[model samples]
Target: MQFQFHPLTRKEATELISWRYDRPLDIYNIKVDTDSLQNTVDFFVDPKNSYFAISSDLHEFTAFCCIGADAQVPGGDYSLDALDIGLGIRPELTSQGLGSPIAIATIDYAKQSFSPQRLRVTIAAFNFRALKVWQNLAFLPVQRFRKQNGGNEYLVFIRNT
Candidate 1:
């Protein structure tokens, strides 16, 4: 299947905020308001920040993911040497083998787009599927830490590009 990446517009962000989805990435729990997503989109639209979403060629959003410069990484100050990334596919599409390509493509895109030496993703320990995906994609576990949301520890995996 073919795919394209769209830089979400402010209006699109607001619209997407209301689009309901019963899954892990639900906006409600994240406290993502119109302004937050709007600001996110604004940062993504800026060439200085490396963030984007990948969609199918049919114009459907097959996945949502982003890569942040060091300054944007959750735990530390911005550093040009590393990038923080996150991703989630529609729950309905899980276990369909669509992840491999999208994950790899997103990584390649981030590498080329940001020119960072390392790419990182913080995945929950309970997400076996994601762990497998990251491993299959060659991301090695570098560190593990607890999350405030629960007792689950997040594994910080890294990929050298």
Candidate 2:
């Protein structure tokens, strides 16, 4: 399946916030709370963050990703100057061998948008699937720590751009 990145639209953002994945997959879901859909819409209308709606050749929204400093790492720490990235595939698309393509598109978009020496990704320890995907993409484990909020263990990986 061919994939491409496009600037996230308000409609896409709304759909993203409304999407809910089942059980285990929900663990990695993007958490956004706003009083109204418009508020949620306003949040993503920023130029600084490279927010992209991952779409298929048919222009269907398959995933959402951001390449920016807002990526949260456990303890809010990172050793190197890097572009932090976050990604999420559509709920129904999980475990379907689509993550790799979406990830590659995000990384390629980041590489073209920013000139960081390295790229950093923080993944929940339980998300072994994502860990393997990043590992396959050549991102190496750099740090492992627990989130103070939920105490969920997280692994930070890095790869030179």
Candidate 3:
């Protein structure tokens, strides 16, 4: 199938409002907060952040990610010049070989726009799919931290830009 990326708009924001968190994957993998999603959409819709929705055949919003400049590293790791980007695919799309290319596109966009020295990805420790995807894309483990949600902590992956 064909794929393309579109800027998330107000219309898309409204559509996300209807996104049901009932997918089996959501119960175990995704951390969806309605308010946060809405706020992110509102912020990215601004001209400043290069956030976009990935689509198949330019028809469906399969995934979304953001590109930004000089994101502060959470643990004062000055070596990390960029922020770990956020990405999400509709739960139905999981384990379907869609993440790598979409992530590569976002990384390429970030490299072109921000020229960061490094790129990072933070994944929930229990989310094996995400860990594998990021690892496949050459993101190496840099750190880990305890999360209030319990279980294992989040793993941070870093890739030099």
For candidate 2, the lDDT comes to 0.82
Q: Which is better, 1 or 2, measured by TM-score? A: 2
Task: Show the colliding residue pairs in model 1.
Answer: 70-78, 71-78
- Which tens-of-lDDT digit does each residue in 80-135 have in candidate 2? 78889999888877888887888888888888878778999999888888999999
Q: What lDDT would each prediction earn against the true structure?
A: 0.65, 0.82, 0.67
Which sections of candidate 3 miss by over 4 Å? 21-41, 48-50, 69-79, 148-152
Error of 2 at 137 (Å): 1.1
Query: Candidate 3 on 52-128: residue-level lDDT in tens?
Result: 77777634887777655422224434355655576777666667787787777778866775677888877777778
Q: Best candidate, lDDT-wise?
A: 2
Model 1 spans > 4 angstroms off: 19-29, 32-49, 69-80, 148-151
Tell me the spans in candidate 2 whose CA falls farther than 4 Å from its real position: 30-36
